[model samples]
Target: MKKAFKYRIYPNKAQQALLQVTFGCCRFVYNKTLDIRKKAYETDKTKLSKFDLIKKITPLKEEFPWLRDVPHVCLPQAVYNMDAAYQNFFKSGKGYPKFKSKHRSRKSCKFPSSHCAVLQDTSHLKLSKLGLVKYKKDREFAGVLRHIVVTQESDGRYYASCLVETGADAPEPQPVEASTTVGIDLGLKDFIVTSDGRKISNPRFYATIDRRLACLQKHEAKKTKGSKRRARIRLKINKLYVKKRNLIKNYIYYVAKTLLRESQTLVMEDLNIVGMVKNHSLAKSIQNICWGELRRVLEYKSQWSGHNLIFIDRWAPSTKTCSHCGFHNSTLTLSDRSWVCPGCGTHHDRDINAALNIKRMGLASLLPAVSGFDGRGEVGYGLDEASICTV
Candidate 1:
């Protein structure tokens, strides 16, 4: 398995200058090569491979001598990065690769294993051109180093993310049973509501900083552009954003860890988050809650821990369906927090009922071949026929 460990690095003035030059060189190479490939394809329908682009780096250095100032390896890595982006576009029908701007794009460069190393003392990192940069090693990591990506954030902080091969096989997935399985519904009101009656309150990290963030932005807008004062205001705004992101990341990790620790089989609705965010009134709240980030964390963590993570169909009517008697409430509105099933007279808390329905549907989907249930109906695997028709 491959995992990445990140550490904050403190570099001297000279090293910082060198790092900035390297970032510019890498960006230049990437953009130049992308332009070359794009023009080739357009003019002659010719396709240029990564190696072809890498071979051009030597000629580029001869033409533009400043490129030789950075480590030779960094240029090729840029080509590789561009190649990966193109490959993803071709394979997944993703957006076409666009030119990276110095001001708008992320400033970063990658170094292969041969060009980067962690010192034995664990307090410093060694790069080909930037040697012995000091870093805060918060924890020890054991694995074969694959590569390191050094990045400079908008807040002017430097971080190095080291990718390593752990060499440990993933654990075997446990059997999915009724008692061990759980269904979760993610919402803005509560971060998560599980079928087992657990509600993890939404922290609303962004809300806590909204006023300060707005004030900073307002001040930034007033400052003269290209002035030191404007830069200072911009930095402050970036720092505020960084702080908010970190808070949300930590909280999401905690929520995912807590849920995975209890359940072996975890199920959730395949929410159309992009569509949901289109609602102007809820967009801010939706983004701040980060439903997508929580789902992403749960996915990878569940795989590492041998837990089954299942996502039910997006259109499965989990919200309006009654978990008790499988009664479908067609008239339920978004404002109705709790509703009583007309058929079974069972009262339901909206979110919890949705979670329970999601759980049942997921379990039913897993056993469709044996249960004779198509997994599309409101009534799930074990529901009695009489109860299913009660409505």
Candidate 2:
């Protein structure tokens, strides 16, 4: 069982500068290599290979002498990045890699850390050429690290992820209390509505912090791009984002723990959030819910705890179907929070109804029940009475 734990790092000021420089150089190299590969593949048919990229490193170093002091593996990593890009491009994953912006750029660097390597808890990690440096010690996990990723976010926070090998097999579970099944509905009005009748309110966190964020953005926009003042504002904006992120992460952890304590099986709607966000009206609200983040935490925590996390499809109409009477509303509107089923004449509290149906739908899909009963959890095009209740 291999697992990875990522922890935020608080490096000293000097370390921060070194990281920024290294990140910039790596980003430049990655883009350059990708560009070269793109042109080559377009002009000729040969695929860019990682080994070939390493062969070119010597000539590259001669042309860019400053790179000699940097980590040797970085060049190869850049090539690997291009190979990955080509694979993705071929698979229609995303648009080609474009020139990175100074402020709105992606920021991450990877260094090879193999299994059986010596590392310390709360001690320095040695990168090639870069000397061992102090880092903030955080909780360690139950695995031998196979890789480490150092990332600097737009907000200027650093993180180190240790990809570890726990073992080839899963460990026996510790004793726990008897558990129950839960169906969850993630939304804007409520963070989540569970089949067990849990209504976790959507904390309008960004709504609370939006003004300050807007102010910071305005200040940042006033400064010249790449100027020290712009950098300062950039840092300020990043810190605000970090704070919100931490708050959301903590809340999610707390929620997952509470739910796992009671439930063995988690039934949830597999929402197309990225697609949902495409609607201009719901974009901000969608980002605030961080539904995707919550689901990821739920999945990993369930895996760690030996619980089943079932994702229902987004096509089943968990919302439009009446949980009590099994009646379907063919034309339920978004504004119709409360609705009555024409066939069954049953009144529904939209969200609660959705939660109940989800619970029913999930059970139907995942469990074997008597006739006329289906699973309580479902996710699909709520666009057509395909709605999951807001509960």
Candidate 3:
């Protein structure tokens, strides 16, 4: 298993200058290599191989001697990173490789520990050409260090992300407590409603800062380009963004932690957030919920903590069905918050009913395989199919 731990680092003025040089050189190499590859592919149908790119480095250094000022290890790593990016794009159908900008791109350099990257002690990191830098060691990790990525955030803070290779595979999923199963329905009105009837309010962190953010952005726009005032406003906007992100992250972690602690088996609806965000009316509120981030956090944490996380299909009629009677309400509109079931005369709260339906569907899916419920929905054990909620 591999994990990364990031900590704040304080580099001296000389080291900062050296780091800036490295950042620039690495960015230059990445952009140049990408441009060369794209042009060659377009003009001559030639894919510039990594080896071919490496072969040009000598001539490149001779033409541009300033590249020699940074650590020798960083230049080749830049080529490798670019190659990896292209490989990822081709393999995953991600966006095409794009040029990096010094002002817009993240300032980062990765150094493999085998090549002049080391930890002198718990509180210090040493890199080639750059002396031992001081960092806060608030937590300890047990593993062999593989690589370290030093990043300069937009807010002018430095961080070092140490990747460690733990000599073990990730723990396998364990059997969950059947009594602790839960289903979650995510929404904007309430952040999440559970099948068990618990609701967590949406914090709306971004909404809280929207007015100030708009003011800062407008102020930044009025300032002349390349002026000190524009730079100052940009820094202020970046800081506010950083603060907002941190707040959301902290709240997400807390919520995920609490949910995982309570439920051993958790189920959530598979939402099409990218499609949903296209609606101009609800886009801001939808983004403010941060459902994607919440889902991501729950997924990894569930795996690490031996909990089961399941996603029901996005097309499931959770919101339009009566959970009590399994009756699908075709005429139910988004505006209807509460409704009465025609089939069973049961009243349902919109979000809570949706959560209950999700839970029922999740249990149905899991139970059929585990409890010998056959294709015809018949249980071998004389028990009602609905009674065995095994998710």
Best candidate, TM-score: 1
**Pairs clashing in candidate 1?**
none
Q: Model 1: per-residue lDDT, tens digit, 1-391?
A: 8888999999999999999999999999999999999999999999999999899998999999999999888889999999999999999887899889999899999999999998748699999988999999898889899999999998899999999999998888877777788889875467789998888887665785878999989998998999999999889889988888788888889888888999888988776765755757644455545678888888878878889988888677789878877778999988898999998898899999998887877777676332333444344334543222110
- Error at 296, model 1, angstroms: 1.4
Question: What is the lDDT for 292 in model 3?
Answer: 84
Error of 1 at 59 (Å): 1.5
lDDT of 3: 0.80
Which 10 successive residues of model 3 have the least lDDT summed? 372-381
TM-score of each: 0.92, 0.83, 0.89
Across 6-112, the per-residue lDDT of candidate 2 in tens digits comes to 76666677777777777776777777777666677899877767677667767877898877656666557666766677678769767766765656776766777
Estimate the lDDT of model 1. Answer: 0.84
TM-score (C-alpha) between model 2 and the true structure: 0.83
lDDT of 3 by residue, 1-391 (tens): 7778898999999999999999999999988888888899999899889989977777889999998999878888899999999999989887788889989999999888876454546588888889788988888788899889899998999999999887877777765444577889985468899988998887666776767889999999999999999999999889888888788788889999999998878988776766665757644544545788889889878877778897888677779877776667998988888899897788888999888777666766675443322322111223334433432
